[model samples]
Target: MITKEALERVRGWFAGRLPEDWRAAPADITVDREEITVRLTIPDVDLPADTAEAEADEARAGRAKAFREETREQRMKIAQEAQHRYERKVSWGVSVGGREELWTHVSAPVMTRLRQPQRLVLDTLVEAGVARSRSEALAWCVRLVGQHEDEWLGELREAMGHVADVRRKGPAA
Candidate 1:
């Protein structure tokens, strides 16, 4: 887990490094052990309010793609510098109007040990065609839990941060 101060520093660095015109608002930064994801809210395209939903979506996607292509070189340069400084891969994404698109990002592999019961659960998911393999099954399970228990998870994370703060204030070993 990243310390609160460290995460703040990471956010501050990106806030300072990013071009002011690239985002309509401050970037949303998420940092983890493996990577940092920066999501910017870009300007929306102008269109008639009566436009069809499909057409509106298409326009938003086109805008996102154009932004990605236009800023690719500069984004790569920033990502390289950030990755070198932070020792973590950096990913980029943009939200235009109501549509969000993520560019190429790292998908790190995770290794885990599970008992027979856990293995059986993953196998069941694979058999049901919910996932292609145990790894996918595990990821699906995690996503489900995250979606269903987001509030609880958020509270738990907050508690964990408090614990970290308390630990830091304790006497030196």
Candidate 2:
């Protein structure tokens, strides 16, 4: 958990540095569980103080409007860049099998590329007892299953069929 003083220091820094025309670039502080998080948005630069500033106020208004639009675009680009960095850093682990069995552990940039609904389906299957557990299901889905999940389920179904066959045939028989 970050201290209140720490958060204030950060807010103060941004408030002092950001441009006047930003309108609002205040830091938002929130506490989640034991952690304190701060979200900060950069301020847009004020319009230039050239002769254009002394001309009709409408011209200044137009420049300010253009600046705000440009700032918004820059903010979005920055957000995307930050998101890509976060996605690269965050570790989402998927482990297969139990103790003494072959367990493949996957992580990082590999995890986020996974299709959302397909991942959810595997999670649901694990909850429904089709797969063993959450981690097991995720690992099986990611590593063994290819991009085409329907085809992968068909393969799993065939493997399950063979297991049932072996069970019915018996080693002694």
Candidate 3:
């Protein structure tokens, strides 16, 4: 978590310094690797600003992107300068969707409707000392399948990607 003071400082930095594009240049502050990352989120300048309507009840979504390849030179320079001035590591970034969804370890209740046979299988695992409970057994079984059929799963994911691409292109005439 970024400190409130640090967050405010970044806001103040943009408000005071950055030329010509302050209000429009939205930003975020995060603490990572013991450094204060001052990310200046530049909007899609590619979008037609002079569009007729406000594009109400809709958001302008670019590609599901991660770690943008390009950014305004000035923003980066200013961030680096701030890093030097504050004697703290300050980094800048301009991304479309920003960060990727990296998974974190989680232990949460999950609701599932298993077939009677599948439920019996889970109970069998517990009885055989393979798992502590039905849920644990089910999870263990999934992991076993995932480990054995990694490549097959990868191919299935690739197929899903193609399906998504086709869907995005819309139905044929």
Q: Identify the leading candidate in terms of TM-score.
A: 1
Give the TM-score (vs. native) of candidate 3. Answer: 0.39
lDDT of 1 by residue, 1-173 (tens): 88888899999999999999999999999899999999999999899999999999999999999999999999999999999999999999999998988877788899999999999999999999999999999999999999999999989988888888999999999
Find the number of clashing residue pairs for candidate 3: 0
Stretches of candidate 3 off by over 4 Å are 1-104, 171-173
lDDT of each: 0.94, 0.45, 0.58
- lDDT for residue 130 in candidate 3, whole number 0-100: 99
As for candidate 1, its clashing pairs are: none
Q: State which candidate has the highest lDDT.
A: 1
Root-mean-square deviation per candidate: 1.3, 22.2, 20.0
113 Cα displacement, candidate 2 (Å): 21
RMSD of model 3, in Å?
20.0
